[model samples]
Target: MNAYQESLKIKRDNYSALESAELRGEQRGQKQGEQRGIEIGAELERAKAEREKREMAVKLKTKGMHIEEIAELTKLPIEEIQALV
Candidate 1:
């Protein structure tokens, strides 16, 4: 091939390679973001369950139940009920 033709071919090949690399990078970033979102959602669910359990303990305490009895009824640790009181 002539020098001019060879130069044009090289330029085309370089452009194609750059385009492929950019597409692969974007896909990798998207997958990482999705994984992060799933993790955050799981954390929120765990926090909500803990809050509800604590609220139930407080309600029982307000009803004049002894801390030890409350712990037995709620199946929670006596220390946890005492802390709520």
Candidate 2:
């Protein structure tokens, strides 16, 4: 190939390499974002469930239920349920 043509080919090669690297970087970023979103959603769900359990424990406590029974039914620590009194 002529010098001019050879120079053009090298330029095109460099551009293609850059484009491929950019695409790979974007894909990695998107995957990381998705994983983080999933983790946040799971954490929120766990928090919600814990809140519900505590509410139930409070209700049972008001109903004159025994502390040990409340702990077993709500899957809460005895000390935690006792603190609700």
Candidate 3:
């Protein structure tokens, strides 16, 4: 091939390689973002559940429930239930 034709072929090959690398990087970033989003959502759900359990423990305590019973029913630690009193 002429020198000009060879140069054009090299440029095209380089462009194709660059495009492939960019696509792979984009996919990797998207996957990481999705995983992070899932982790954040799970953390929020766990916090919400913990708050609800604490509220229930408080109500049970007000109704004259013992600390041990409140801990068992709410799945919270005795120390946490005592702190609510």
Candidate 4:
């Protein structure tokens, strides 16, 4: 082939390779972002559950429940119930 034709073929191949690489990179980034989002959602749920547990412990303590009774009622450790007071 002539020099002009050879140059055009090289340019086309280069562009095709570049486009493929860019698409692969974008797909990888999207997957990573989705996984990170899921992890964050799980962490938020765990934090909410822990907060609810603390609130219940505080409420039971306010009712003047003994530490042992609180432990029995709340099913938490005696020391943990005492600490709540």
The best candidate by lDDT is 2
TM-score of each: 0.78, 0.92, 0.91, 0.80
Q: What order do candidates take by lDDT, descending?
A: 2, 3, 1, 4
What would the per-residue lDDT of candidate 4 be over residues 1-85, giving only the tens digit for each residue?
A: 6999999999999999999999999999999999999999999998888677767888978988677776676667777767775
Residue 8 alpha-carbon offset, candidate 4, angstroms: 1.0
Give each model's whole-structure lDDT: 0.88, 0.97, 0.95, 0.84
| Best model number under TM-score | 2
Deviation (Å) of 78 in candidate 2: 0.9
Query: How much does each candidate deviate from the true structure in C-alpha RMSD?
Result: 2.4, 1.3, 1.3, 2.2
**Pairwise lDDT winner, candidates 3 and 4:** 3
TM-score of 3: 0.91
Tens digits of lDDT, candidate 3, 1-85: 6999999999999999999999999999999999999999999999999999999999999999999998888999999888885
How many clashing residue pairs, candidate 4?
A: 0
Q: By lDDT, is 1 or 4 better?
A: 1
